[model samples]
Target: MRVKMRSKHRKAVKFYSTCFGFREPYKVLIDGTFVHHLITQRLLPADEALRDLLSASRVLGS
Candidate 1:
């Protein structure tokens, strides 16, 4: 699934990915911290980190 981020939460995404042992570099810096892809085609769970991110970046009527 493709996820569109509302805001580029760079540090948070990187930190979370790192914590989860995501793909190498674990930190892709683009669009001011908007992670285009995560975990090399792996499915990300609906965890708190993602929830917080979504809540923070949630767009209206989305």
Candidate 2:
């Protein structure tokens, strides 16, 4: 994880995998990739809300 995430953008991607979420124990997932895709597609309203959360926390760019 450290090797792959050496930059800010990459580190931000890692947050999706580590951050709290609605996880399905029965349905396996590939961590960050799945959630990242959904965010890019804007399929979830929480996507923008979450970015705003990060911005407020000064974690990511607005």
Task: Kindly list the per-residue Cα lDDT of model 1 for residues 15-35, writing each as its tens digit.
Answer: 666797754322323342334
| TM-score against truth, every candidate | 0.23, 0.26
Q: Which pairs clash in model 2?
A: none
Candidate with top TM-score is: 2
Per-residue CA lDDT of model 2 for 1-62, tens digit only, reads 13433355445645654695522221222358757866796757643444442333322322
Count of clashes, each model: 0, 0
Cα lDDT listed for each candidate: 0.43, 0.45
Sequence-dependent TM-score of model 2: 0.26
